[model samples]
Target: MPDHPVPDPGRSLEGPLAPVTEEITAFDLPVTGTLPAELHGRYLRNGPNPLGLDDPVQHWFVGPGMVHGVRLRDGRAEWYRNRWVRSRQVAEALGERWAGGPVHAGMDFAANTHVIAHGGRTLATVEAGALPYELTDELETVGPCDFGGTLPGGYAAHTKLDRQTGDLHAVAYFWGWDHLQHVVVGPDGRVSSTTDVPVADGPMVHDFALTERYVVLLDLPVTFSMAAATAGSSLPYGWNPAHPARVGLLPREGTAREVRWSEVDPCWVFHTLNAYDDGDRVVVDLCRYGGSYDLSALSGQGPLTLDRWTVDPAAGRVGRQCLDDRPQELPRTDDRVVSRPHRYGYSVVTGEAGPATVRVDGSFADDAFTDALLKQDLATGRVEVHRFGRDAVVGEAVFAPSAPDAAEDDGYVLAFVHDPDRGATDLVVLAAQDFPGGPVARVHLPARVPLGFHGSWVPDR
Candidate 1:
């Protein structure tokens, strides 16, 4: 490990972006505009929230996980709640033991990064930690889930749900394990299969893609390093040029041995919007980075642009093209169109140097931050943007379907925006179809919600 000085925790865990100190529940949140009566659900987001004030390791992604959520019902802002995922590391740090019961061997739960509701349960998940922790609609931790002791490894933070099949698919990798496993959770919330895909090193597989017939696996060059791990580095993964950059097309119902690998230029993808099958090729849209791993600068030193990759299975090749050149991340689309072709997508526009900016090139300019939300019409190549100006920063925008059978883009784009001037956060709701217009409603919160990763909307049943 290269010799380096101690990092300042204030950079990642202080001020308007600071982590909440404790768990709290607030009732009847204040709203600025009228919330849609059809918008009834919880907008829950999860991210790293360090418990220790003087934490020795201060990497942005190294802290314990905390979730901030808001409840909406009958056009009224119901309540707000924030809670830690209660992993073993979090339990010990808080001087508490795991009251839930004995944990499974080799399970390390952080339950951060992303949260999703499926099969009648909400799972709080991280990429390489313990199994997902079950949470109630109110944000209470029920306990860890191993699919009833069937999951062989940790669950990936981003799992693709098949709308056609009602199945949950994930590509998971462990820190010390040489092979990654492709896990399938059935509609009944049980682990159906665990197929081990052998590889020489443990690469960080943050997210994957799914089409009508296959699961797309990204085996990039960011590999785990034992030197950095033992040297007290907060993030131990580094770029290995020797490792081949490739995309694996695995049959949805087959084992790992049936996967077909195709070579592509070296890159990293932290998240994907949507993917679909097109005759003999599979097209996937995602935010692509050029370099290896850097925890201090999660986006790395490359241009973080929205790109589309076309994978030709027979040719054993992958082609890429930039959809929009503006710097952006956290691309999302309507979940109802996931695993198939969709016409609309949404992303957060990152600016030069601001509070919520994930500097892709490791250089932070004075005024750089994510300043706007972007809406793209994939069918017509039309782009619309919603800017927040200079004093505010925006998080990922999740689309909530307007009705059970509404059109693909007929819904609201919900996100948390932190205003440094006001020193508070607001849940901004924008009409998905009216991207040129401003927010339909701004649900004000009692506290400032620190910038975090992915989130999901669970509509009231």
Candidate 2:
């Protein structure tokens, strides 16, 4: 299952993955330092914009889910919106209308990637099976949310929020499903629990690892590609070295015959920087992609380190450990230590990579961006970098917790930076124990927040 070739769909969407065409909203924006009057609310990001910025895009995660908010309160940086998750083909490609709800397996498209906020709503997720699009805390588009209907299936884009029983844990998958479900949404948003599990080459479970007893499941080696979805490929998943690189665990109330698989060694995890339950062993930590899409181009794959995985279900074994070999990816920790034990982790800094860069107008761009912003320290391995140089492009950094029992590196880290010499975009922040210092605030965003994928500092609870 390794040589399926066929990936070249053309790539370039102009500049930092360009795609902004309107939908502005601005307000009291401009700020530079000091903004933490207990740092109030909305940082909400979610990407894959693409409402046809000159067409040609078979996969940059299949565009069409934009959402870039920024609100704050006491110490104000107040408003700065940018919606477009209308879905139903972005509301029929903007002629308007659809924004309506309930479209489970029939998948109403665009929910971009991540923009969480459990029970009290505010979601916009996306993954193999799509079905979450409820925004509206100023981001509009309140539509597809199967939870009230109890969500029987389809929904995922990384949803693990169990700050101790507020449950939310997702793991859905569906290239037509040969199994892999594990939902759990309770906390009043519904879908109490689910379990499926099966498997055998439908893999692409993008992200998973939530430990307060286990839900880990990352079957690895990419998988799912009906020949790149019959070659139209809007992200048809790839790299299937015969699909057998396991790690299942399951049992946070168990089922699927109680899960527990364990085999590891073929890597590919999109994100996860936290997981815990030591004792009977569970550990996790992530962002290790020794391979991906194989040229089915997600920046054409590989180069991302910082691993760790213990799993040891008594003796079933799964021990990986490579804590930091540089090259990084979008990890983040401290959503109140999601799924438990965490000692700080945050990433962004995909430097030293190569692949998707053929722009002499022949298109194909995505030279990784992200010039620095890490903060590891997973119990004393200490890493704190914060470079933002090479003209700045950084993306996912979210941490924001100076209270509600603060003390885990105690405070802010936010991030949206993209200051290619002030062409725009700021929102910086960073002061979690002042690691690489400078920038206790920055806000200044009137536009250009392009480079994305995963965000939340939602607060205002």
Question: Which tens-of-lDDT digit does each residue in 1-461 have in candidate 2?
Answer: 11111222234566666766666788899898789999888999998877663267655666778889899999888888888788776676677788687887677887888888888989989888879889889988878889888888788898888876888888989888899998888888899878888898788887898887788888888888788789766667778777778888888863334787978777677778878898888898897766554635454355568888888887888888889887778888888888888888988866655433333222344545556788998888989898877767788898988878988888988888888888888988988898597888898877787776998988887
Candidate 1: C-alpha lDDT = 0.79
Tens-digit lDDT string for candidate 1 (1-461): 11111223333455434666656677888888889999988999998776663364346675677888999999988888888887766666666686473354566666778999888998888876457888888777778887777776677788988877888998888886778888989998888887878877788888989998888999988888788889977667878788998988888764335888998887777788999999999999998876554544554566667899999999998999889877777899999989888889999876544222444222345434466889999889899999876778888999999997999988999999996667878999999988879789998887778778899998886
Pairs that collide in candidate 2 are none
TM-score on alpha carbons, each prediction: 0.92, 0.33
For candidate 2, give the lDDT of residue 445. Answer: 78
Any runs in candidate 2 off by more than 4 Å, and if so which? Answer: 1-21, 28-37, 40-42, 54-60, 64-67, 73-77, 83-205, 208-217, 221-226, 238-242, 248-261, 264-273, 283-310, 317-333, 336-453, 458-461
The model with the greatest TM-score is 1
Q: Rate the local accuracy (lDDT) of all candidates.
A: 0.79, 0.79
